[model samples]
Target: MRRGFKTEAKTLALELRAEIGLDAYSPFDPYAFAAEYGIAVVQLSDLDGPARHHFLKADGSALSGALIPNGTGVVILENDAQPLTRRRTTMCHELAHVVLEHEFGVSLSDERKCGLSGDQEAEADWLSGEVLIPSDGAFRLARANATDEQAADAYDVSLAIARWRMNHSGARKVMQRARAKWA
Candidate 1:
């Protein structure tokens, strides 16, 4: 990702936070936020191929605003059938896609084994992490030397997400140091 574009994406996220009453370090429920913004929430067990793989999509190729077709103004989220936290993260990822207007055809990475490849996906994941587990919460938990499960419980997020947040927020070194000291 280009530095300019990355900054732009962060700016967009900040703008969205202000627009939707989310602060710099406040946790926001993606599902409820979507509902407030008129984004539709869908949970179907078995969807078709494209629907299942895409996770979410707009009416056509335009990925700037809500995914609602016509005048519905609804954002659609495909459930992964995981826990509520996972579902919320997925929805937040989709919302990031919309806000970022990620390029539809560009490939972020060139790994055949990896399914979701793109700079867009990475950005979306970062955005979702910021939204769900804000910096303050993550920093507090990290400073407390919280376990993975404890952090997850505190943040109301999944273990995987908690770990990722820790890693992304530059807590990996802190965690390593704590583990070594305890060991």
Candidate 2:
């Protein structure tokens, strides 16, 4: 994570949520967001041939998702074979690329690779985290002393994502300080 990327992501997340008319604690509907943004979300299985192989792999090194440029809009291809939560994360990541208006390379592989530049990937990942689990939502859960399981349920996200958000979003520290003060 860069020095100010997290802050930028947080701001962007909040603005996007507001633009989409979502509450701070509501589960973000990536599909709805994509629809509003004029992006199409397609499943990997729905594709044929090489495109399918590019996203779904027999090995675990499969791509989670990719954002492809259309004529004027964007198309998001997700590996739907994965769990729903994973798919959601992938969608958000691709959506982050769209929202950030990242320039596409000439080849699909350039934009599709799992290993993008560190800063780009980090920014997208951080923004996707904020999109899925807003800072305010994390803070609310943390203040309630919510477990990772609780956060996952509340946010409709994977346990790993919930854990990361709770720990890294400044929520856990705030909650801990509040608890200490009360004690």
Worst ten in a row by lDDT for model 1: 105-114
User: Counting only residues 3 or more apart in sequence or on different chains, how many pairs clash (N, Cα, C under 3 Å) in candidate 2?
Assistant: 0
lDDT of 1 by residue, 1-183 (tens): 455654465556656766777765555567666766766766544557675545443542212112334343434535445557756666677666656665332211111111244565677767767766666566677777778888778767778888887777666676678778999
- What's the true lDDT of residue 168 in model 2? 92
TM-score of 1: 0.63
| lDDT accuracy of residue 34 in candidate 1 | 70
| Residue lDDT tens for model 2, 125-146 | 7898899999999999998889
Overall local distance difference test of candidate 1: 0.59
Error of 2 at 76 (Å): 0.7
Residue 166 lDDT in candidate 2 = 97
Model number with the top lDDT: 2
lDDT score for residue 51 of model 2: 67
Q: Residue 154 lDDT in model 1?
A: 71
TM-score, prediction 2: 0.87
lDDT by candidate, in order shown: 0.59, 0.80
